[model samples]
Target: MALQNEKNNRYLLRDWKPENPTFWENKGKHIARRNLWISVSCLLLAFCVWMLFSAVTVNLNKIGFNFTTDQLFL
Candidate 1:
């Protein structure tokens, strides 16, 4: 069942056929590209956050954390 809820700006598509050229030309391409970029950006941001902690830990002594080299390695 295809339902369009204008008040909520929601469209429920019961069937999806991306192979249909008309649909892809009209809407699918834009949606797909937008989602792809969003996903890629989120992944990159997550990777940066994950790596930032390691960088901070490596410089903990410089920041006055009093961590020894051995402790830093651990």
Candidate 2:
């Protein structure tokens, strides 16, 4: 059965075939490596932001917020 394509004009099926040798060697490898680095950088940045929150909350006592050490642990 023939299926109608999506509205974006791209194929909808998963009939993928990476048969072209040069296309695989050049374009596909570059795109894959760049995407991997982008993912790693995003993960590191998220961890850094999380550490910032930890530092600020630890010093909450210095700001005279009336939160005891036990309360902060909660």
Q: Model 2 — which ten-residue stretch has the worst lDDT?
A: 9-18
lDDT of each: 0.80, 0.73
The candidate 1 region of ten consecutive residues with least summed lDDT is 1-10
| Alpha-carbon runs more than 4 Å astray in model 2 | 1-24
Residue-by-residue lDDT tens digits, candidate 1, 2-50: 2335444544444466899998889888778888999999999999998
lDDT of 2 by residue, 1-74 (tens): 23344544442433333477777586656666777999999999999999998898899889878787788777
Task: Give the number of colliding residue pairs in candidate 2.
Answer: 0
TM-score of each: 0.61, 0.58
